[model samples]
Target: MPGDALVHRINRIQGQLEALKRIVTSGEADCVKTIELAKAASNAIKKFAQAYVETHLDQCIEEKVAVKELHGEMRKVVHSSFSL
Candidate 1:
């Protein structure tokens, strides 16, 4: 349930951000529309980061409880997502 909820939330935010990007570059809207879309994109990015951090914390707890070092194993995903 937690994983599903996390993934669903992230996906929805991603979709919204993508749509907003399209609107920003659609060339059919005014500056107000672009500004609003940019704000939406910023909010979506924040939400996505929060959701991902929560999910990662959950994963770390589950791994520690299970006596497994999944944190080290997930370096690729972590780096790709959190690093520039």
Candidate 2:
């Protein structure tokens, strides 16, 4: 059920991104509207990433920590995810 909710959110984000693309390609959206759509899409992506990290990465790290396996690989993964 939670995964289904996440997939639904991801699909919604995809639709938002497609709408933003259409706005850019159609050349009908004004600067303000374009900016608003872009910001919304960006925020959605950030929220999804945050959710993924919280749900998946946190659990993974917790598991590793329990086994004293937290290492450079985990740091690299987190750094790369944020660096984008």
**What's the number of clashes in each of the models?**
0, 0
lDDT of 1 by residue, 1-84 (tens): 767876777787778777776776786767786677778767777776777677687766675664346666567566876776
CA-lDDT, candidates in order: 0.71, 0.81
**TM-score, cand. 2:** 0.75
Question: Would you list the clashing residue pairs of candidate 2?
Answer: none
Error of 1 at 3 (Å): 1.9
Query: 66, model 1: CA deviation in Å?
Result: 17
TM-score of 1: 0.51
**Model 2 C-alpha lDDT per residue in residues 39-75, reported as the tens digit of each score:** 9888888888777777787677767864445787677
RMSD of each: 4.4, 2.7
